[model samples]
Target chain A: MSWLHIFFALILLPAVAVGMIRILKGPTAADRMMTAQLFGTCGVAILLLLGAGMANPVLIDIALVFALLSALSTLTFVRRTWQPGKKKHDDPLS
Target chain B: MTILYHSGTFFIGIGLLFFLSGTVGLIRFPDIYTRLHALTKADNIGLGFVVCGLSLQSGNWAVIVKLLLIWLLVLIASSASCHLIASSGMEKKIKPWTRP
Candidate 1:
């Protein structure tokens, strides 16, 4: 059963990896941040599977933290980082 | 008991499929608005399925509750953040993609 749990966890890795490509190719800051959002949810799923696989409930606590922090991060990104009336061209690299 | 385990595994598999589709949409969608749609909706559902699958396999009541709570949190957070991102993008005058 642990192996089954671990196998499911392993499968989610590619989803996160593929999302990274979007970060690289993203034309806007929000695009890159969206990848970060993807990471948050994927990370939560991975952590949950690992918790079940290892029989460590502590990881569930960590998964909870992951969920909260991801929300806060995105909230900050929108309110502070992605300011209103700011031109999209304000990004230096793009 | 074995039936429960197999069903849990099936749910997890379905969850993984949702996750895969969400990732594909995030990567392939033409605009931020469309991508936000993909990320928020699909990913939250995927997380909910995973939580359900895990809770089904878990014997502990506390863990099951926690898992459900986490799902609720992610659902609320993702949707709120999605709205924020879309509105922010609009404020910056970012246009939606049109079919060519």
Candidate 2:
């Protein structure tokens, strides 16, 4: 059973790694913010898999904390960086 | 018992496949909104499967509830964060990607 779980972990970690590529060179800060969500969700899976594979139940609780707090960074990023659109019209007289 | 474990493995495999597709979409999609759409949808579904798969091995109600809770929280976070990012992008006037 543990071996089967270990197999799952091996595949799941790479999924997180693939998401990281976007974080490294994504076009904007918002794009990078998506990475935070990816990490949170993926982290939960990996932690659970690790917990199951190792027979360590604590990891699942840790994963629960990870899931609960996943949105914090994205909210902070959007508040800090994203500005409201300004309305401006080009005027010929200026 | 063996059949149950095998079924669980099958679900996990499918979840991983979706995770792969989501990452691919993230890379290939034209812009942030599209990437957000692809990832939030794909990853949530993937997590759903993974959680179900894990729950198969959970002999106790507490473990099942804990697994479900984690997936539920992730689902909410994914949708809410997607909204926050997309709205913020719109606020900042990050133009939506359009195909020529």
Candidate achieving the largest DockQ: 1
For all candidates, the clash counts are 0, 0
Residue-level lDDT for A44 in candidate 1? 99
Whole-model Cα lDDT per candidate? 0.91, 0.80
Which ten-residue region of model 1 chain B has the weakest summed lDDT?
B1-10
| Cα lDDT of model 2 by residue, B61-90, tens digit | 899898998888888778877887776677
| CAPRI classification of candidate 1 | medium
For each candidate, what TM-score against the reference? 0.93, 0.89
Backbone clash tally (model 1): 0
